[model samples]
Target: MNAWNEKYLQVSLLWFAESARNKADPSVVTKDDQEAYLRQARFAQGFIREEEPDPPMARTYSYQQPHALPKVQRAFDRTYATRGTQREPAAEPFATATQSKHMDHGQPTQTTSPLAPQGRSSGQIQVTGQWDKTPIKLSFDPDASGEAFYQTFFQWAVKRKRGADLDRERTTLWLKASKATPDTQAYDLELKEDELEELWNTAVEWIQENKNTKAPHLYATVEMEAG
Candidate 1:
């Protein structure tokens, strides 16, 4: 069998054996039963090859070192001699215009400015943008595997709409997938608030269009909030 099939079989058998042990009756520890379990375990170990040994170690050294500086003290004296001191009168101011012609025209000019109260807090509007994802499950045909489905959907839905608004330097997208059963798959898309609504609507349309074989299930709810 292939590596994936082998791994799946091994894990499944291990889980089955563990469940059997947990649910086994207290009175059923017969010699025959013990022998059968041991034989199965041996067969599993023999079927799975041991991993290859790691490579030889390489020589390494720490080159960091500290140094101390020498302290020195020296004294030199010079004598200052002054001949005389003189005072001069200040210059008179020139009669020039103070106003300039250039002014910003893009924004509206304010005639009356709001007065601030003494010892009062500044009333500035601070915008705190946030986004979150509800638990969403989307199903696709078996042919559409890996992360391609979610990646494609996101590129068209969330990324396209909010690509400009997103702080590419700080933005991130998270996806969670689950294969609860061999035939069923679920995917959850997590994104920021500015793109959440667009993502939701686009996802609904995408699932409806792409999933033709079997009617896929989709459930979305806010999981957590991020700023």
Candidate 2:
């Protein structure tokens, strides 16, 4: 049995004892009274309190020490590259000839790399380096806005070439986006070592821009296992 069931049994026994003691007349207590008391005790013993499970502990897991990625094994790979820019086409043929303001400033904008295709299979890229050694979990508020918030975050991450692994069929991005209710849409994000800082910054920025004014109580937590 679970710890909660054990606790309920103990509480029921105590309540039964107290109820019996509080009876007005000890001599008046009869067989029916005893049976009713026992039944009540049994019912109470069967009761289970409903409560949320404790959030998982968070801490950083360092895989930086030295690790090997064997041949045919999958490893994490990240390549930082400049994201290209797009130019708007001219509205009319001769409109821009005489205008002092010029478009397409001849500068290549620098941005994070675009996300790779989502449906493509992760090939046999090996994970050569170690990752965070400990597990991490995070929770978020649940609501319609929360659902949209996580979806945006996932799309942002996926678009940034950060969502895929050679060993896994599909990268798991956000854990519980669909279940975010107005009251309780807590979600979890598990991260490896290098992703910790990036994830935290993204979450902070998201909260500030999206829910700061009306839902200031909306919050997120970053957790890592205790070492």
Candidate 3:
């Protein structure tokens, strides 16, 4: 089972032993039960104690290494040439000009790129990506507001069975895209919660129309925010 369940079991057993000892006369205490309780207690304490000495070989391990990542070509195909700039006179498929203004999360400021779309439209897209090397997928209507989309993602992530392992405050969602490459350079762009609606709509539009056969699929990454 999981670590939590194992710890809980140990704790429960320890409590049972302690209660039995307190309620029963000293002469009635079983040696086995007392030993079990002491073992459980020690295990529980191990979870909190951090002053334990390091292994003899700890200092010998190398601590520095270059981070390596794949290099992707920077090109936009079948997607809009501009993002968040063109307003559709129809049912408002794109974020308004005002909305796009607040969405500055480290993207190149160029006005022409398939990473941006011409107008808004009604459709749905599938988002597939990684979280700590684990694949994850989610789908939602492209018509939804950026805020709504982010909320849906946030809820899905934090409600997972082992969600406690995620540190929400230091976690952020990013969309992977191509940029000038050293191969080691990061391509993921953060999706800020406040500007998410505008940013998401722009991304969704581009992904829906992207026609480059070799273009990377529009994927997301649940990243631990770097200090």
Candidate 4:
């Protein structure tokens, strides 16, 4: 059997039996049960991680900071009552007019944007979740088998169109794979929970649209667990 078929068989059997046996065990988890329920799932994400706040600043200024000598008699006169301070004489009348001609307020400021990755991402697919499968190479897509084909549909989600709070609800992604495929290289992608949900939603949307024309075996929506 092809690698895809073998994995499909194993995943199906596992979710059917093993999951039921572990319903009471929090360690034995399930997610997207309404869609693709499994002991584990794998995917990658694209989001900026939150950073910790900076430490509070120390008191910098000192009362005697400007004094160079230790014994400082007040040489300077304090005119606080008079509020004594000399102001600059009014600028020559010509100063404002001469500088006004060069006012560059309307001109656009040039800015440089950092360059994006020049080489295209040869990244195959973001996921290659596996199950107990035979080691035989497949006649079709000998390298990636079928996982990449499904994963490509989900990878289309850009950052943020993916809803928030999706990750906390999802299961932990396992990098381990049962078979080696061309797309296997991307399987190790360390995707957070949010990214996985984005991909899952995108793939399901694609499957929903192409159900009749292409792969009919795939369907939309998560499978509600039989309670």
Q: Scored by CA lDDT, what does every candidate get?
A: 0.41, 0.42, 0.57, 0.36
- Which 10 consecutive positions of candidate 1 have the poorest summed lDDT? 76-85
lDDT per residue for candidate 2 within 1-227, as digits (tens), equals: 57867786787667666766787874455686679777866675445323435544679897775664653233332211111112324544457575535746676656699787764233211111112332222234332243343444345335544334211112223322222323244434444434433465665444444442322233333233543
The RMSD of every model to the true structure, in order and in angstroms, is 52.3, 48.1, 45.3, 57.3
Q: Write model 4 residue lDDT over 25-72, tens digit each, in one string.
A: 645545555245423332111111112245456789757656535333
TM-score of 4: 0.15
N/CA/C clash count, model 2: 16
Estimated TM-score for each candidate: 0.17, 0.16, 0.33, 0.15
**lDDT top scorer:** 3
Per-residue lDDT tens digits for candidate 3, residues 1-227, read 45775777776777775767786474576777778777876766664444336634455767887553433212232124334335445435445665676776777676754664534322445667678756666665657777666666666666654366555446666554332223343333345655554466566655556512343344566767665
- Per-residue alpha-carbon lDDT of candidate 1 for residues 1-227, written as tens digits (9 for 90 to 100): 45855785777667556656775574445676577667766766555544325545679998976543333111111111111111212221211122223455776676887787754133211111123432233333323332444344445335436434444224443321212222233334444444544465555445444332332233322233344
> Which regions in candidate 3 have their CA more than 4 angstroms from the true location?
1-122, 162-189, 211-217
Error of 1 at 24 (Å): 99
Q: Of the candidates numbered 1 and 4, which has the greater lDDT value?
A: 1
Q: Order candidates by lDDT, high to low.
A: 3, 2, 1, 4
